[model samples]
Target: MSAEQAESEPQADLPGPPPGPAPPSSAPPSSAPPSPMQRAVQNYLRHVTVERGLSTNTVAAYRRDLALYTLWLAGEGIDDPSGVTGNHVGAFVQHLGTREVEPLKASSIARVLSSVRGWHRFLLEEGQTETDVAHETKPPKLGSRLPKAISIEQVEALLDATRGDEVQQLRDCALLELLYATGARVSEAVNLNVDDVIDQEVVRLLGKGGKQRIVPVGSFARAALDAYLVRARPQLSLRGTATPALFLGLRGQRVSRQNAWLIIRAAAARAGLDIEVSPHTLRHSFATHLLAGGADVRVVQELLGHSSVATTQIYTLVTADTLRDMYTSAHPRAR
Candidate 1:
């Protein structure tokens, strides 16, 4: 089936575990014949989007990985998906993991292999192929690296750094506070509406794949947002528009994600934190602080709008690190 048909099919009306995986796809280039790999990948992507209801970004990632796989398969003269064996897939993964062409990180390799496996599963589900050849495949065991998080004191310092005689400074404070308070992704925070931020107690986040989540606002964040909503947002939006954007740029439209990230970086620089700061740093700090105060992981996962509890479990590593540091400082065993 074509990619469009696979995607637009009425799979919702049928009952079964969701479609496994499909081949990756590529955007059709004008005035060129598509190679067999491109055709198969496009078919795969269509299945993913239509049947799986996946986000376009995810589909895009799969497309890139599958493209690389197909290129390697072409080099090996293996054009047929039906003939692509588990050894071939595994070899492809190994080559991707170790190729000197570019220094591919483990995470990148994992992503590529994952796309291949997804495609394998897709074929099996469609009964176009036999068993899932990738069934025994495994992603590289990634070291459990904790997400970067800062302390409450540093956060206070960062917010205080935004204190100045300028409206932009006030806006930055509000943005910083909202990020740390709501544990929101940068895009969600920037796209927020005045209506979306509830009674100053909660903010509605439109997360990945357009999922809506309600997250509680911390005390400090509520106050910061109140001040921004009362003072700075109006000034920023005063030009000629009656925009509903909770945050605005110099143009008074909704702020861009890059600008939001830049705002956090600038604020961190001014505060002399000297650490890599992004909008997610605030989120990491939010989750870590909550967990340190005994917040439930599942509850945090719900608030963060994570589809899986396993994704949220990474923050626990940060909490564990905090405990270890405390133990090293206070425990009186002879060195």
Candidate 2:
């Protein structure tokens, strides 16, 4: 029976789970052109998009990972889904995790292997294949890494470095201040529209998975934004056709992601700070400072638009390590 037909069978009428993994098949690679792997992958992607209702970013990640896996399979002279074996899956895992070609961090490799496992599980559930070739494949364990943050002094220095009467300089200072104040992702910050800031006190942010949250704007950020909108934004807006984006390029277009990165990096350089800085540095500082000041994890999770409180809990570790370092430096006890 076809995989779709097997799926249509009633629960009680279907045969029990196979006693063991499907026996290895010796069928030679078909002489004809291979097509099943690509077809099956497309079908599985559609299933995830329509039935599972995943976000676009997630679906895109899945597509990218599966594309890499398909390339590896083609390289191994296996193109059909049914021809995939446990050994093939194992080798692919090794290929992703090792430095034989381009080395990837453990988290990146883990995500790729996870995508592979999900694809195989979908195939098995759909009855596209009898064996779950990737069921036992394991990704490398990820190490615990603390979020990187700059001190308040550094952030102040960075923002102060951008002072000028020029429209672009005003906008850059406002952007830096808003990022630190709101703890917004770079994407979220760049995506903001004029209406997202309400009453000069709070701003609305759209986050991943299409989630939206409101974060308060501190007095410093509010003042900076006021200056930009009044003194800088109108001049910038005149450069191009009008747009609703809160942050605009010199041409009045919505600020692109790369443009935002350059703004942050330039400001950091002018601040005379030697540390590596990215847009996320401000976000990390926001979260760490909040937690260090006793903000609840759940509150920070909501403000940051994280789907789970567990993701926000990582900042607590940053705070604890800071305390440990302080104790090591200040305590009177002999080493």
Candidate 3:
């Protein structure tokens, strides 16, 4: 993620930023027929959302990332889906590096590149294009800085900070515990229902790619949910037409993903945590802690509902870090 590597190339067809956010009156030009990449993007977006069953957050990311690719293609005058090449992708990576107007990191570039590759993979499958040029392109070499996971004491402090004798605290406690116990994404957590929590022993999560997995809940998480369901949820629920959602907004409606994130941030802030924490932070910490406690990587992966063990293995990065610390501490020659 070095800035220097990002600043090394200037001669590339750099895509523009997203269509700037504007009021309803300033809608983007739709008068013209869609461009090739635009059409392709629309089709791909539909496939990912409707057929693939990716969550809105994941779909929105594809839109943002793929839009950048489309913009680059438009700028390069490469309208045909059949014309993209490995060189174009490499140039795009360099373009990300050269654009010092705004800071871009190597990790961000890799993510963007990944989206591009995914798009091309789709194209290849559908026969929209014959090339998977993105497949051969190299990602920037990255040393493992490792995923950040706080100590168990920090976790206790984090949850304790959510204390308030009100409906909000109950919701926060449920959300926090569900995240840590089941390792569910914020979207999955918010979309859950009373039925999703099965007798306090396990919860069924609908995860990415429309995959369903049953994950066990710890006693702590179960107790927290029990308290919320008994006290806070009853108070929040209204008479007719109230949602059956396990977690609700102040007015007894199902909470949106954004609101769930807000709840997490508020709790994080209350804990006085200096590092930025998101709902995913809790999930990441959960996976790391579980692995550190000798849970199998595959088991943790299934619990987190990751599509690949490689995604789950990111937690191993934490275990590796702990090993390094042990090495530096215990080995006399190393010191």
lDDT per model, in order? 0.82, 0.88, 0.81
Give the Å shift of residue 229 in candidate 2.
1.7
Q: Which lDDT value does model 2 have at 261? A: 82
User: Which 10-residue span in candidate 1 carries the lowest summed lDDT?
Assistant: 1-10
TM-scores of all predicted structures:
0.80, 0.84, 0.81
After superposition, candidate 1 runs with Cα above 4 Å error: 1-36, 238-244
Which residue pairs clash in candidate 3? 6-97
Model 1, 185-217: lDDT tens per residue? 887888889999879898899888778999988
Model 2: per-residue Cα lDDT over 275-316, one tens digit each: 988999999999999999989899999988888899999999
Ranking by TM-score: 2, 3, 1
Which rank order by lDDT, best down to worst? Answer: 2, 1, 3
Which is the better candidate, 2 or 3, if ranked by lDDT? 2
Ten-residue region with minimum lDDT total, candidate 3: 1-10
Residue pairs that clash (backbone atoms under 3 angstroms), model 2:
none
For candidate 2, what is the lDDT? 0.88
